[model samples]
Target: MYAWAARWRNAQRPKDQRLRDAERSGRPPDQRDQITQKLTALMSTTPTAHGYRHPNWTTPLLVAHLAREHQLEVSARTVRRALHGLGYRWKRPRFVLSRRDPNLRQAKGSSRGD
Candidate 1:
C-alpha cells in the first residue's frame, strides 16, 4: 500500500515503531489493573468466608464473584491471564498421609509387595 511505503520512507521514525502497526482508536480500557488487584486480595481469603461452599477458588468461581461483588463482567480466560501475569501457577491438590502411625509407611510398602 502507498501508506506503508510512505511510512517506511520516513527516516526520522524510530525503528521499533516500524515493526508494529500504529495504535488506533478502539474499545475503552477494561480496568484490568483494578480487577487484578481485587483478585489478589480475594486470593488471601477462602471462598467459604464469602458465603461460597467450595474452599478453593476456581476461574469460574472468581468470575462469578467479581460479577456479584464488584459488578465487573470478565471472562474466566481473562482471570486466568491475570493470574498468569501475576506469576501464579496452577497446582492440583495432592493427597497427604496423616502422621498417625510412625510405621505406617513401612506397613504400606510391605503390603504392596514392594
Candidate 2:
C-alpha cells in the first residue's frame, strides 16, 4: 500500500530528518490543563456571578461562557470530557415535600374553623 511505500521512503531519509515529523499547519489540540483550571475556578462560584440566569453550571452553558468570556470556542462534549477528566461528577438536585407536609397544602387552603 502507499503507506508502506511512504514508510520505506521515509526510512531512506537522513536520521535527523526521520526523527522529526514533517512540518504541518492546522489547529492544535485543546489545552486540557487550562480548561481544567478554568473549570475549577468557575466551579467555585455560582453561574449568576457570571451573569447567567441559571445558578448551576451545565456543559452547554460552560461552553458558551468560555467562548464569550475567555474567547475559547469548544463544544459541550469537550467541556463534558474535560469535567470527567477532572473527576467531576454531575448530580441533579431533588426537590420533594416533607413527609409532615402531606396535608399542609389542604390545611393552608381551608379556613382554621372549617
Candidate 3:
C-alpha cells in the first residue's frame, strides 16, 4: 500500500517528470486492414470459389488460403483472432434429417410396451 501511494504521488508530480506508461517495444501492432477486408469478403462467398475443396472456412484452411492467395504467412490462431476482431464468428454446419419414413413415429409408438 505504501509503495503504491508513493508511486501514485510520483505519477502526480510535474508533467514532464511524471511517470507514464513505457513505450511498447516489440513487433508493431498488426494493422492488416486490407487483409481483414479481403477476409470478410471471402467469408461472404463460398470457400469453393476460393479454390478450397470444402464449402466452409475453417481457421487452418483460411490460414492456408491466405498464404496461397495473398502471400500472407499467418497462423491459424492469428487468422481466428483477426476474424473475431472483424466481427465474424465461427459457425458449425447444421444437419437435419432430410428423409424420414412417414410411419416411423407410429412404429416407435407401437414398439414401446408402455
Candidate models: Cα lDDT each:
0.87, 0.83, 0.78
Greater-lDDT candidate between 1 and 3: 1
Q: Highest TM-score among the candidates is held by which one?
A: 1
Residue 21 accuracy (lDDT) in model 1:
88
Residue 45 deviation, candidate 1, in Å? Answer: 0.8
Task: Show where candidate 1 strays beyond 4 Å.
Answer: 1-26, 101-114
Superposed by TM-score, candidate 2 places the C-alpha of residue 92 at a distance from the truth, in angstroms, of 2.2
Give me the runs in candidate 3 sitting further than 4 Å from their true place: 1-31, 99-114
Tens digits of lDDT, candidate 3, 45-106 = 98888776996888888888888888888888888888999998787889877888876554
Per-residue CA lDDT of model 1 for 1-114, tens digit only, reads 888878787778786675468689899888799988999999989999999999799999999999999999999999999989888889997788866886545555456565
Best-matching candidate per lDDT? 1
Greater-lDDT candidate between 2 and 3: 2
Any residue pairs clashing in model 3, and if so which?
Answer: none
How much does each candidate deviate from the true structure in C-alpha RMSD? 9.5, 6.1, 10.0
Task: Give the lDDT of residue 89 in candidate 1.
Answer: 85
Model 1 vs truth, CA RMSD:
9.5
